[model samples]
Target chain A: MRSVLCYGYGNPGRQDDGLGVALVEQLETWAMAEKIPGLTFDSNYQLNAEDALAIAGHDLVIFADATGEGADAFAFRRLVPHATIAFSTHAMAPESVLALCAELYGKQPPTWLLTIRGSAWEPNGALPAAAQANLAAAVVFLKEWLRRPPAAV
Target chain B: MNPEAEKVFNAGAARANAAYAGQRRNVTINPITRLEGHGKIDIFLDGKGDVERAYLQVPELRGFEVFSLGRPAEDMPQITSRICGVCPTAHHMAATKALDSLYQVEPTSAGKKIRELVYNAFTLEDHALHVFVLGGPDFIVGPEAPPELRNIVGVIGKVGLEAGKKVISMRRRVREITSYFGGKVVHPVLGLPGGVSKALKAEDLPKFKELATAGVEFAEWTLGVFKSIVLGNPEYVKMITSDAYTHKTCYMGTVDANNNVNFYDGVTRVVDCNGKEVCKFTAKQYRDFIAEHTEPWSYMKFTFLKDRGWNGFAEGPESSIYSVGPLARLNAADGMATPKAQAAYEEFYNTLGGKPVHHTLANHWARVIEMIYAAERIEQLVNDPEITSPDVRRIPTALPTEGMGIVEAPRGTLFHHYQTDVNGLITMANMVVATGNNAARIAMSIDRAAKGLIKGGHVTEGLLNKVEMAFRAYDPCLGCATHTLPGHMPLRARIYNQSREIVQELVQD
Candidate 1:
């Protein structure tokens, strides 16, 4: 079975760390509007190496997480599994877990981590103007990704 | 890098160990997750048989107190609820109570019942999350289990699918009840100065009863599973009951006139293990009894019982008293009033004794027992005809110059004190978070457990995970604990210490 699992990873309490959740929320809106099919979504603040085991059986796994890199409010990059560590901001980077899964299970899903650049992560729950700009960009990307069938490796 | 080699470099091994007598070996977890804000765990090992020192560091420096300087007193609960999502209701109630205290306004008879019902709903929701989501895995998956299996999904996989579904269903009930009362689970905005923002509707009572009744059954089944799987095991029982790291400290919490566990508007009481009352005071009197200390590296504050002051690593439980959430609250109370809670209370007291439970491992068991209490309390509240009344909220007409709110969050007792000027703008604010209450205690427990488990600086990943899981037993929401993470380090430790003390003192992030 070709399973599609989508995740939104970011610290929700942190202002724009909420982007991943917000992006997923926005995608839910888009999914309804554009009628995307064969997709299931789960949003978590962070998923460590061990937690990734739950994503088993997925053929196409789309991981969306927050990134501290802010050349742009948000940028769309099709990340290879290894690229996740460079941009991922979590306890156990998505790449590290994906690597572990590959080593243990002989294979991993065709994984791509989509990072929505975050600007606000201060103590105060303040969202920056640039982070707000990414909301639309993230939603647009999700809509496009959903509009097509899963790309096999 | 290899951990052993890294440890040699970090510890300074033979040279520093032999030469520097005054130097101490320390390990610090810079960021502790699932807590209110920011804090760390520091372990000072003399590399000897005993734990040289264990400090749970809470160094909140963003000054929510100062941040609230210009906000309205009426909005204290809402603002403070952002202090933590897990215990938003605790802050909300505490803020409301503080406001009422400042205004010297007590809720009417109906308002009292409404507050109680709402408080019950809040506790049930908070406690359920901890039981099913946070603490459940340890018991269900077994403490020595693999890291990948140490979570809710693991619990579901190990236990029957039906049992897992029951936990989820009960959690949904809890969320539903809280949502019905508070509008949403993320940040509740229901409480006001004198009472809640909204009252229970007629339809809410029956629906609530149905959900709560189902929850009661679920809790019982879950507890049965926990009893067989966790508490029943000889090793688990020994670990929890052993005196190896038992920290005996004074227990403080709110209790009603009859000495029953109360979440809102109760006399603040502290009792010893023998159930002797050490002190009796009001929530407003906390400042007189509690003082906060800060570590340089952490953004969380360590609050100690004022009289005891700071007890440096004397070892055992006495030197490291810790508290918060239902276990502490239960230990502080003489008896439970809610029928199910009372019955469970009798059993728990008989088993554990009538004092503060010192075993951090038991925290998971205590949490599940409280889940029973929360579920039962919900049933009682929903069955009461008053719960159905539409008079759920009573808006405050004026803001008080000063207010203090205190409610038992899922983790423990939470207090929010706010001071406002004549213009009703907040001048000062302070939050005694639930996790903060047990900060010292958790550190001590982990230190003792680590010392007992770790031989000659050797520890299995499973042991390390258990130490971490012990902290999870509190179900801390570090989001509220370290609100000032992205900011500059609070302070550097001291001279002779190349490393920051706070960084060395707190649990791992």
Candidate 2:
């Protein structure tokens, strides 16, 4: 069985920014009910250097985050190890994480980014109706995507 | 859209632009990336193009205190931690300590030790991140190097792949110790009212002991790396002691009974520019010593010494403006509590020309010394017999009222204050984050660097980086300083001519 790691990061306290983690939560529940094998779930407020090691251990990884940019409700794209200078210690781009993994751990597992559209970012505000719709659509698409064989993915 | 209305709008915009073109030129470093949150530096230039006044603005603000109102006081530890992903543990520990003060209950000896152990481990890792990644490019990879050669990748190239791997491994192990207790390093759930939610198990002691030992070794090696790479280069040392980065402001930090630097708990100590003790106060008495001064130009409130008063951005013995963080902490305390760190402290002072080194760039060296202290402290705490004791909490019976808690975060001193009603619901909440405490001094640093570097309207990428180096040494976390979302923003610097027309633009991704 191929080991797959699903990592989502964003501040849940912020209204629409929580879409990434919210999707992971729903995905985890569905995956558990289906008794999916070799699939792991993790989350945090944002991505950091330590996450490189986490992705290195898996055969496949998916990084989920909410994006203020993009016209579509959700977009998924394959990731390559690309090193970019990070501005802050608080967070790092998904590509940078993959780059760090390749450099430090000598492993560049197949990776993908799932960006869901978000609008509001107010503190303590609930997810807006539009963001919820985007999240649901992303979740449905992800469930189908995850069911595919590792080689095909 | 009507054509006549469009014409009218265009004419109005032209008039406004023409008016702005006649005004004094301004140089703005917007969205200063690579640090937490969004920061912008605006340097207003005189007619000759020399800097007149510079302001550092934090545009994004979250209503954290307002959000805390009407919530249960017990929820603060969790809620406040969510404010910044970079320093969640600092907020968690501060809020936990505040809860102890609110309930008027002391944590069991074991619980206090556990908290200390976890805190030191966090400091070691966080400081490592800054030293190896965030601040590394400036010194480690050489400030004069090209932008592409001045990042973590560059540091790896200079230090070799093995060293890079070691840093990742060491940070992973150190954070493991934090996650073991807090349940998660990002948003820890360990702190309770009087104690921790869980106690350290005996079986886990061996692994912690091993990790602590490895952490100390790693820190010692890091100190050696700094000694060779940063301290060995005379140019780097000259830059560190340069006048543009020097400040004569007061310093503040927490210290133990022996006047040694402490991160977890101690009396707050304040020292003047000459390194003489100004005052010592408890967490509850912070208001008597420190006050926040507001300016209409920025969202951040500058913290100053209350007795001396707010005397603007001037730096001297009489100036109320003070700084916190590694260098300040070292200057405020007599020595480090641990032996190896104490020797390092002596070397740092001797090499830098005695107590209270005034150079801002010296903060990078001071931070490395702190790593030694944190690692040694972690080793001491984990080996104590009381570490494994299960008596971690005491029931609180006292009524909730007003309480305050303070901790030395990796960046600087952090304070959490709360007032609760009879039902234990929060009435008011306030926090004095490290970046806010250093805001005034940071503004002065930026202004001074801009004046020294940019002359005759010439702003080079290297020069602007030097200006940024002044504040980057502080490792200011604007995300934690203000309650804002932690997101990455590109760095852009725009210079407006005397007529307020765009003269030059520089952008970095």
TM-score to native of every candidate shown: 0.77, 0.93
TM-score of chain B, per candidate?
0.83, 0.92
Model 2 error, position B7 (Å):
46
Q: What lDDT does candidate 1 reach at residue B322?
A: 43
Model 2: clashing residue pairs? A87-B34, A87-B35, A88-B34, B21-B499
Across A1-153, the per-residue lDDT of candidate 2 in tens digits comes to 889999888777666766778888899999999998888998877776778889999999998888776799999999987777655445677887898888878899999999888877765568999999999999999998899844666
lDDT of each: 0.60, 0.82
Interface RMSD of each: 9.6, 4.2
Write down the lDDT that model 1 would get: 0.60
Candidate 1 Cα misplacement greater than 4 A, ranges: A1-13, A21-65, A69-114, A143-153, B1-51, B54-63, B102-104, B108-115, B294-300, B311-322, B353-356, B481-509
Model 2 residue runs over 4 Å out of place are A149-152, B1-37, B60-62, B480-487
lDDT of 1 by residue, B380-430 (tens): 766777766665444556646766767777677787777778778888887
